[model samples]
Each structure stands twice: as C-alpha cells, then as structure tokens.
Target: MHCLEVNDLVHRYRNGDVVLDGVTLRIPAGSIYGFLGPNGAGKTTTLRLILGLIALQHGAISIFGLQLAAHRIDILRRVGSLIESPSLYDHLTATENLALLQAVHRVDEAKIGDVLDLVGLAGTHRKKVGEFSLGMKQRLAIAVALLHEPELLILDEPTNGLDPNGIVEMRALLTRLNRERGLTIVISSHLLAEIERLATHVGIIHRGRVLFEGTLDELQRRRRTHVALATNDDERAIALLARQSIAATIADGRIVMPAMPNTAIAQVNRRLVDAGLDVHELHTAGDDLEAIFMNLVSN
Candidate 1:
C-alpha cells in the first residue's frame, strides 16, 4: 500500500503564483522516496500541501488511504516532518526542546530519550541548543519529528548546510530508520547526488510538473545507452544484428547498438559468434542521475 498519495494537486499564492500545477505523487510504504527538483520546481510547495501547512487550493491528498481533508488529525498523528529551517529554541537543551513538543503530542516520557539517542543527541545532557553546531541543531529537529513515532517521515532539504561527515551521518540515520523501523520517508532535495545515493524510488518535478516517477532501477533502465561494438567485420555485424531485430549502425568505424541489458548483450554476443564473426571489443555507457535530472528539468 502507498504511504502517501497526491492526485492532480494545484496550488497558487495570493498573488497568483502557480507553485504547483496538477502535481501527483505516490510514495510506497517502506521506501526512501526522493522528491527531486531544482529550486522553484515546486518540491517544497508540494510537501507543504501534503503536510496541510497551507490550505489546499485544488486537488486531493491522502495518507494510508485516508483523505487528508477528512482525516487531518488522525493522519497527522502518524506523520513526522521537518520542513525548511527547523524551528528550535536556542535557550533550551536538546531534552528540553523535545519535551515541549512531547507535551503537545502527549507521548510517553521515555520517547524523549529514545529519539534523543536515535538522533545522537543523548550525550548532550545539559548543553543548550544555542551552542550546538548546525548539524546538532538539525538532528534535534529530526528528534522532535520522531517523538511521535510516526509511520511516515517527511524532510525538506534535510542536509542543506552540513559538512561531509554530517551529510553522511544524516544519510545513514535515514537509511537505518527505513530499514530497521520500516519508516516510509519522503525527502525533498535539489541535491541530485544525495538523492541518488539515498532514494530507492524517485519523483522528479520540473516547473510545477512531475516529469518522472518510478523505482530507482526503473529510472536507470530509462537511461539511454549506446553500445559501441568492434568486431572483425563491422559491416557484417551491423547487418547480422539488424536481421535479428536488433538495430545497429556503423559509427566511427564501429557498430553502434541501442540500449541493451547484460543479458541481451550476452545474447547478442552469442548470435554474432554463431554468425562466424569474431567480437573484439565492446563498450556501453548511459546517462547518470545528474544527466537524467538535467535533461528532465531542462525539457
């Protein structure tokens, strides 16, 4: 079952800035779904709409098969989020900061320390949030989100300004949460590399439209690849593959073939060898995540 769903969602500001135009998403349970887009691509706006931070201008949203409008309170109880800059109290210690929210959620007191330890802030017993590093502050905000032990976690730009080590830590934490706790995470980011590293599924948005949505494996499959093959007889190889319904052409004195997975490549190799052709060299490359992302957003 899907953890969250957005259908034909449309949003506009008072000034008529159409931030989202018929945006739709389906995030599966136990998935680290990457909400990817460039800045102003409506990633944040879509997230806010799902969180009910703003009134829905048009379209519908549902979580766990329950319409958000009809079950806002009930649905929200099973969701945790940290959008944009985290709201944190500078004067309060990590424990104290989470305590205030814990009171609002009316959760068990033990949850406070559980989340603190989960976010690696348990050691800072008396240190006020004011003196914490940027990474520490970010972790505290996540702890606040997890206090309720929501089934779904949504984070926007969770690693906006972290150092290399901090970024790695955040990635590991989210992965563990999904793997060990079976948490469904929706993470929005303009950072293609980070999302590529973390997301099992991806939804790419461009100019308020969803250009692509599918599993990471499916996305990779969509990457257009060309195989450059060198054989004893390039001309004969081209003719031979064409007869086998595999289109090929002579490019740069080598046969160029369309995208083929390893199994297909092996089949092609067997076909050529059986045709009395000596295969000498073969190379293939496809668009990476960054390339695919750029192509999607640019178009």
Candidate 2:
C-alpha cells in the first residue's frame, strides 16, 4: 500500500509566488523515500502540505488510504514530523521536555522512556536540553516525534547541521527505525550522497516539479557508464568505432563511447590498433547520483 500520495499538488505563497507547481509523489509503505532537491525547490512546501501545516490550495493528498482534506486530524495523528528544526524548551530537562509533549499529545507517559532509549538519548534524561549537543537535541526531537507511535515520520534535512559522525549516527538510527519498527519515513534533503546511502526510493524535485521518482536501482540504472579512451588519432578512432556501429564522442581531448563488456572493449581496442590509431589510455567511468541530480536540475 502507498503510505502517502500527492497528485497535481500546487502551492503558492500569499505574496503570489508559486513554490510547488503540480508536484506529484507516491511513497510506498515500509520504504524509506528520500525527497531530494536543491534549495528553493519546494521540498519543504510539499512536506508542509502533506502534514496539513499549511492549507492545501490546489491538489489532492492522501495518506494511508484517507483523504487529507476530510481526515486532517486523523491523518496527522498517524504522522510525526520535524520540519527544518525540532522545537524544544531549552530550559527543561530532556525528560521534562518529553513530559510536556506527552501532556499535549495525550500519549502514555510510559512511552517517554521507550522513545528516549530508541533515540539513544535515554541517559540524557537528567540533562537540560540547553546543555545537549546538536546531535543529541536532534535525537531528542525524534524521540518526541515517536512518542505518539506514529506509523509515518517526516523529517526535513534531519542532519542539516551535524558533524560527519552525527550524520552517520542519524542515518543508522533512521535505518533501524524503519527496519525494527516498520515505520515509513519520508526524509528531505539536498545532500545527494547522504540520501544515496539511506534511501530505497527517491524523488528528485526541481523548480517545484518532480523530475524523477523511482527506486535507487532505477536511478542508478538510468546513469550510463562510458568508456573514456585517449587515442593518438581522435578522428580515425571515431571513424573506426562508427564502422562497427559504436557511437563515439570526443570529450576533453579523449574519445568516449558507451561502456561495453570487457571483451567488447578489447575488440574496440584491437580495431583501433589495426586501423593505425594508437590507443594511449582507456578506462570506464560511470555517473553517480550527484551527476544525475545535476543533469536533472540543469535541464
């Protein structure tokens, strides 16, 4: 089942600036969906619309088979969100902060301990939130979100200000939450490399539209590998490759062609040699998620 679905979503600010334009997305249940885009690409706007933090202007949003318009409160009850940053009372102890959320949400106080441990912040219960590290505070925020036992968690740039170690810890924690608790998470960030490590599915948004949405494998498959070969006679090498129906282009003073198997590459090398074109260097290079993201946004 799809955990969330948004179709033809269009959102504009009161100032008349269109931020989300016909954005559509489908996130399957039990999957980690990475919502990726550059700054000002409307990623946060879409998340807010989904969570009912903002009124829906021109689109349909469905979560867990319920229409968001008619079931705003009911749907929101099943979702936990941390947008941009987690809101916390710095003066309060970790446990005290959670106690406040428990009272507001009316969640069982017993859940506090469980969530703190789940987020690796159990030992910090006596510590004031103001004294906690940024990473610890982030974890505490996640604990607050989980206090209600929501099935879906939406985080916007959860690792925005973390050090390298903090990033890794957050990634591991999210993965564990998905695996152990069966939570469906939709995380948004512009960091392609980070998402590449954690997401099973991805949606690339740019200028308020989704440019690509598919499994990580699908995105990787779309990125073609190419053989970069340096030859003494570029034109001659191109002609020789064309005679064999292989397309080639000259880039950075080297001949580049679609990647083939090792045997095929060897045959090309031999053909170039036989045609009197001296092959100097040859290697295979493939585009990564960062390259794919750049290409999509640039277009």
Using TM-score as the measure, the top candidate is 2
Stretches of candidate 2 off by over 4 Å are 230-254, 260-264, 271-281
What would the TM-score be for candidate 1 when compared with the true structure?
Answer: 0.83
- My TM-score estimates for the predictions, one after another, are 0.83, 0.89
Scanning candidate 2 in windows of ten residues, the lowest lDDT window is 118-127
Per-residue accuracy of model 1 over 80-108 as CA lDDT, tens digit each: 99999888999999999999988989999
Specify the poorest-scoring 10-residue window by lDDT in model 1: 282-291
The C-alpha RMSD of each candidate to the native structure, in angstroms, is 4.7, 2.6
- Model 2 has an lDDT value of 0.92
Off by over 4 Å in 1: 227-282
Clashes of 1: 0
The residue-by-residue lDDT of candidate 2 on 1-299, one tens digit each, is 89999999999888999999999999999999999999999999999889888989999999999999999999888898899887899999889999998997898888999889888888985779999988888989989888998999999999988999999989999999899989999999999999999999999999999999999999998786899999888888888889899999998788889989999999998888888888899889888889888988998
